[model samples]
Target: MTILKNRLFWPAAILVALLIVNAFTSNQFVTVRDGHLFGSLIDILRGSAPLVLVALGMTLVIATGGIDLSVGSVMAISGAVACLLISDLGNQNSVGSVLLIIVIAIAVSLLAGLWNGALVALVGIQPIIATLILMVAGRGIAQLITDGQIINVQSGPYATIATGFFLALPVAFLIAVAAVVLITLLTRRTALGLLLESVGGSPTASRLAGIRSRRITTMVYVVSGGFAGLAGLIYSANIKSADSISAGNLIELDAILAVVIGGTALIGGRFSIAGTVLGAVLIQALGVTVVAVGVPPEATLLFKAVVVVALCLSQSAAFREKVFGRFTSTRTEAIA
Candidate 1:
């Protein structure tokens, strides 16, 4: 009964329902071909990888009572850095060049993360405002790096990061899974998760208790930035080009939505990485469902909006109490 009452329950149920619906609507929704999983389900996992990464980072930030609106822009910047580096290399296909490019992009992202952390922690700026500064300027910075042009690179290994298969699964999906597992271990297996929740729940009280709220808050933003950068790499690899304008556009919203749907409160405190992963998967599934059910491309966003509203409402305790409370009371009375 307690498990059923958990915040994750409704979201998980909705996700399962969506999968069933997809299976019924599409004959090939789940299929195995040539010893590789090939279906709308696999497609959803592959497509959702970047969003999952972003949401994972968002989860940590939100757990610390902060938000990162600059994730999308960070994605753009990282992708631009990587693709530009690869383009400038004498041999774009050289394995060493691709490896160096990846390292440079990730390094730049970490620096951006450090900058965001400094503003929020050292300057005492609100998280939203602090991140917004980067959010607004980061894309322009990316355009400057790319010289207002899309950067194209032709490298099999680089392309494989997004499109290749590893052990019969998409590399992108594997990356997401690995991230989830790594974060889960880091948060659950140590005291970090509890300390973060303490700071988010009440900074003053945590500070009095000897918790370094400032440092914890800054770390979350840094983690968020790093995740966004990795997501950028995946996005760029998918299209074989980094278009500064289009890369990771509006992705921050999706990541936040995923975190919310995963049962994380905006006010901060408790967080569930598993729940966030499920939420990302659900969002991806919803997009795939719209197309599979023959919804017009023009109305896809509307349909998604409706579904999101329904899911959020269904998960609301007040709404559930108003609708199901009376029924539960009646059942209890009858049993008594």
Candidate 2:
């Protein structure tokens, strides 16, 4: 009962249900092919990797009582930077060139993160407005980098980032897992998590306690940008091209939804990386389920909206109490 009541329980249940549905709808949904995991289940994890990365970063930003609407734009810019550099290098296959391209892309993302942080932490601008500036401008910048054209690269190493297999599992999935583990260790094994919670819960109080709230806020945005950059790399790598306009189209919404469904309150405070991962997986699984069941493309978003609404309601304590108060009362009386 206690486990069932956990915030993550419902999302986990939904994921399981979706998996079952997919299994029945497609006989190959759970098969292994050529010593590699294949089918709808693997596809979900592979496809969800980028979103998972973005959600991980969003988790940190929301934990700091802030949001980064610019992540999608940042992702586009990251992809643009990498693809443009690779296209110009004339040695796309060279390991050195690939490494340099990646480094430059990450650097650009960090700078974008810094810019966002400065606006919010130093200029005292609202987070939404601050990030919005980049959200609108960053895509244009990516277009400028690509000269208003899609930048395509023919690098096997770069493509491997998304499509390659490692130990019979998708590399993208491994990257997401590694990111989650790194973030978990950084937050739980250190005092940073508590400090972030303090800042989110009460900025003034945290500052008075010498928590360096501004710095923490800035750091989180930077981290968010970095994650978005990595996600962008994965996105471009999967397609072998950088489409600035569509690289991360509306991914911010998906990331935000994942964070919220993972039990992280929008107003901030507590956060759960594990929950966020589960939420990302759940969203991807839902999409896979919809496709497997042959739901009309137009109704797909409607189904997602309904599920999101239900999940949000389930997370609402007041609503739950109102609906289940009688049952709770009866259970307590029986216990007495």
Candidate 3:
């Protein structure tokens, strides 16, 4: 009963329910095609990779009571940089060149993140306004990098990042897993998690305790930007092209939603990487479920809203007490 009432339990149940629904809708929803994992389930994992990576970074930022609105723009910039370079290369298929280009793209995103952190931590600007400046300008910058045109590349190794299979799993999914593991170790294995929580709970209090809140806040934005850069790479590789206008459009919002749905409060404090991963997967699965169940294209957001509302209600302790507690009381009385 205790486990059932847990906040994460509901979302897990909902995810399983969605999976069951998918299984019923299609005979091969969970199949491994041609000895490789290429099913609807795998598709959800691949599709969720970008969102999961972004949400992981968002989780850290939210833990510090800050938001990075510029993540989408960072992603746009990263993808634009990578694809533009690949397009310019004489040997687009060279793995080494692609690797170097990936590093350069991510480096640019880190710089963008540093820019955001400096504004928020040093200039005392609000997180929203500080990131919003870049959010608005980032795409324009990406457009400039791409010369107002979409850049397509024919790099086989670059494409492998998104489409290749690794140990019977999508490489994109594996990348997201690697990110999740890195974050988990960084927070759980170190004192950084507590420091972040302390800062989020009260920046002034953390500063008084000599926590260096400013540096912490700035560091999170940098990490967020770097993760967004990775997401950008996966996204552009999935399509084998980069369009400045569409690369990471509104991804920040989705990442935020995933973080919240994963049980991280917007007001900051404690963070949950596992929850964020689950939330990202759930959201992506919802989209796949909609298509599997034949929901109309225009009604997609509506369906997602209904599901999100359920999750919100489930997360409310008071709501759970008022609703499920009564049932438990009734069952106990009947047994007595």
For model 2, how does the per-residue alpha-carbon lDDT over 170-286 read when each residue is reduced to its tens digit? 999999999999999999999999998999999999999988999999999999999999999999999999999999999999999999889887887999999999999999999
Q: Which residue runs does candidate 1 get wrong by more than 4 Å?
A: 1-3, 327-336
- The whole-model lDDT of each prediction reads 0.91, 0.92, 0.92
Q: Count clashing pairs, candidate 3.
A: 0
Residue 254's lDDT in candidate 3: 88
Q: What is the lDDT of candidate 1?
A: 0.91
TM-score of each: 0.95, 0.95, 0.96
- Each prediction's total of clashing residue pairs, residues at least 3 apart in sequence or on different chains, is 0, 0, 0
Ranking of all candidate structures by their lDDT, best first: 2, 3, 1
Q: Tell me which of candidates 2 and 3 scores higher on TM-score.
A: 3
* Tens-digit per-residue lDDT, 113-222, candidate 3: 99999999999999999999999999999999999998888899999999999888999999999999998998999999999999999999999999999999999999
* Candidate 3 RMSD to the correct structure: 1.7
Give per-residue CA lDDT, model 1, range 76-189, as digits (tens): 999999998888888778988798889889889988888888998889999999999999999999999999999898878889889888888999999999999999999999
RMSD to true structure for each model, in Å: 1.9, 2.2, 1.7
lDDT over C-alpha atoms for residue 134 of model 1: 95
